[model samples]
Target: MTIERAVPAFAGFMILLSVALTHWVSPYFVWLTVFVGANLFQFAFTKFCPAALVFKVTELKSAGQS
Candidate 1:
């Protein structure tokens, strides 16, 4: 998949993983959930997600780029 699609797909997977960890692993995992949510919120405005950077380094073209 392109970077555009991969970024959000990875984020959704991480959010779900954090939620599951919070429920089954430890309550402190809730902090991960909060972090991911906040990161997503800020990314909407900043458009500078670290994951996107990684995707770029890996040479994944965005849909628009293609």
Candidate 2:
């Protein structure tokens, strides 16, 4: 998948994983979900996604690219 798609997909995966961890492991894992949500919120305006940068290194295209 392209970087644009991969970033949100990874974020969603992280959120679900964090929720599961919180439920089955420790409540502290909920902080992970909070963090992910915060990042997404900030990214909406900043457009500075670290995951996107990582995906870029892997040469993934953005939306409508390639």
Candidate 3:
């Protein structure tokens, strides 16, 4: 899938995984939720998302091949 689609899916999966960990594993996992949430929030405000950067780099390399 494209990076546009992967970012949201990754975020959602992270959230769900964090929640599951908090309930079944350890409270420390909740920290992951906080971290991921903060990153996403910052990305929204800055319009600078790491996942997008990764996507762009990957696309560039692939395009350079052909």
Among the numbered candidates, top lDDT falls to: 2
The TM-score leader among the candidates is 2
Ranking of models by lDDT? 2, 1, 3
lDDT of 2 by residue, 1-66 (tens): 888789999999999999999999999999999999999999999989988889999999888776
Question: By the TM-score metric, which is better: model 1 or model 3?
Answer: 1
- Give me the overall lDDT of model 1: 0.89
Give the Cα lDDT of each candidate: 0.89, 0.93, 0.81
lDDT of 3 at 58: 75
In model 1, residue pairs whose N, Cα or C atoms come closer than 3 Å (at least 3 residues apart or on different chains), thus clashing, are: none
Which window of ten consecutive residues has the lowest lDDT sum in model 1? 30-39
RMSD of each: 1.0, 1.1, 4.0
- Answer with 2 or 3, whichever has the higher lDDT: 2
Name the TM-score of candidate 2: 0.91
* Comparison by lDDT, 1 against 3, better one: 1
The estimated TM-scores of all candidates read 0.89, 0.91, 0.74
Q: Give residue 52's error in model 3 in angstroms.
A: 3.2
Q: Which residue ranges in model 3 land beyond 4 Å of their true spot?
A: 55-66
